[model samples]
Target: MSVGDGRRPEPRYSRIVGELRRRIESGELAPGERVPSTREITRQWGVAMATATKVLTELRHEGLVRAVPGVGTVVSAPERATAHAPAPTAPAPTAPAPPAPAAPVRRSTPSPAAAAGSPGGLTLSRIVAAAVTVADAEGLTAVSMRRVAAELGVATMSLYRHVADKDDLLVRMMDAAIAERPLPADPPPGWRAPLDVAARQLWGLFRAHPWLAPAMSLTRPQLITSAMVYSEWVLGSLHRHGLDDQSAFTAHLTLLNYIRGLALNMETEREAEAQSGLDSEEWMDTQEPALRETLEGGRYPQLARLSRAGYDFDLDGLFEFGLQRLLDGLAVLLDEGTPPTRA
Candidate 1:
């Protein structure tokens, strides 16, 4: 929204509406073509969810788009006969334009348009937030500088003034997402307790933001300081158990990889759901007949038995079950007082 300080800055939502309107009018987005969803609008424009909704709301009020329940918002089909009719002798008066978007907020943090050299407001927080929002909602593939800038209601080059490029921006995004939650100040007593606590915390984070698991590399993970903090927590738990440096480090990686391995499926499953328009349970139901047939073969008696019963396939259940069994074996080493290196 604009201030009364003489500048008639358009509201952020208006800017978004203008762009989408242009797309609709220019046939860039054809009739029945899906316009950006509210979530996409939020990510593409560094505006609040309400602003994104307003963008769609305005477009809809103007007869530019309409929402379809199962599908999504799409451009409204023009009335062909009326559209081709001769123009009236007198033109309709133009409605006043909305308030222009307020001057980009200059922030010390990247909230919107922070000055590059400013102490804490180094890069554009709005851009990063939009990018992260996109990755969180639609996966990393949907994020791009053009997309981010458009989301911010700014020119594409405007982002370069804040973020270096996509790679640098992605690393910054990783830091921002991972740092969303702080680790516990004090871990619970016992190596197992702390280990469980740490692993579950990471699991929840990955589950909440499925894109995160794919954002980092196992071999050459992004140097996200927030991410390393969790590693330190897990490694410290091992150190207290008298595991040597290598053993502790190895254990840390093992536990991390374990969590990440399962967490990767969260995004995969999400992508599958989006593409197929079926949730996990719905999708699994479709496969039941095939699964039963495969299991009925004489070669797999144990599988056939389990197939008769149903499974939840709960990711959390899977994580806890595997974690306990792995810890049970690790506890053996701890009880025997043998370092992993020695084993």
Candidate 2:
């Protein structure tokens, strides 16, 4: 904190920026070196995302870093240094550094009238499509009306012509995303087949669009037609298996939650990949040393054995395994003729 300024101490983000500046200026973080991402800054400093963002913004203002496409913000090469420090008047030659995982900042100029579909011509499909593209590429946090409008090159208020607000936009986006993958026209002729297809199909949807799983809710489910498709299939499947209304519905919920629960990781993984720019295997490779150290420590014998077993750790395989086991349990439940009604 700055003392005796007759003003409040430096804002938290400014403090964070100062620390980052020290690292960059002192050659500790070399020009073109990757710095902590907003998520990482939040974690290391125990601050909110907005604060972390502010820190990056301040650093940018000081010309301490430059944003690179597909590569996150990096320390600018010395010649390009536009910080308060004196200009060197020459570019310092350095080999290129590896790309880091900073997500794209949407910097597109609001497209000209020719490119941006007419506000008068705005359709619900176009709006939802644009919003989904934003969410899919940048995650759900990037999808505000202003951002969407910027994306579509229309005025922000123009979006209200189709959707009521952001919440309504999200609901429509979810519905549209789900509807894109329609249910199978031909049935497999039995209860288990449809359930398996529904579960796998939903999983695929979540995998394709990680933002999807969290956009939905179970308790206060959105009244969207596409969402009802899976639920109806699951409930009807169980009922066809000789389960009652309460049991069938509960079973459907459990199955949906199971898929939804696992799918939640997709978003988390999506985010980590976005911020780190590493896929699952690549990220795991980066952590191999720490993983090996823990495995060798003997504190987690079972983990060590599993690590030694050399599993591929495929999410799809895991999903299918759980689905089959769940169905097997349901098979046993059905054999019981019917579960007892509670008093």
* Cα lDDT, all candidates: 0.69, 0.73
> How well does candidate 1 match the true structure in TM-score terms?
0.61
Model 2, runs deviating above 4 Å: 1-117, 336-343
lDDT of 1 by residue, 1-343 (tens): 5476788897779888888887766667766677886556756787865677678767767777764323356676663213322233453222221112211322223333422333334346666777876776678888899877655556677778777899999998888777766688999988988888888778767765678888878998788998889988888888887888898888788888988898888777767777986544445546767887888777898888876654435566678788887777678767854333311
| Best-performing candidate as measured by lDDT | 2
TM-score of 2: 0.63
Q: What is the C-alpha lDDT profile of model 2 across 1-343, one tens digit per residue? A: 3587688877788889989988877668877676776656877999986687778767777888765322356787775566554455465444342112111222234354643665567778777877877887788988899988878778888778888999999999888778767787765766878888998788867765678898889888887899898778778777876889998888788888998888887777767777886544445546767898988979999989986665545466677778887877777777844343222
* Root-mean-square deviation of every model: 17.7, 14.6
Q: In angstroms, give how far residue 214 of model 1 lies from its true place.
A: 1.2
Question: Ten residues in a row with the worst lDDT in model 2?
Answer: 97-106
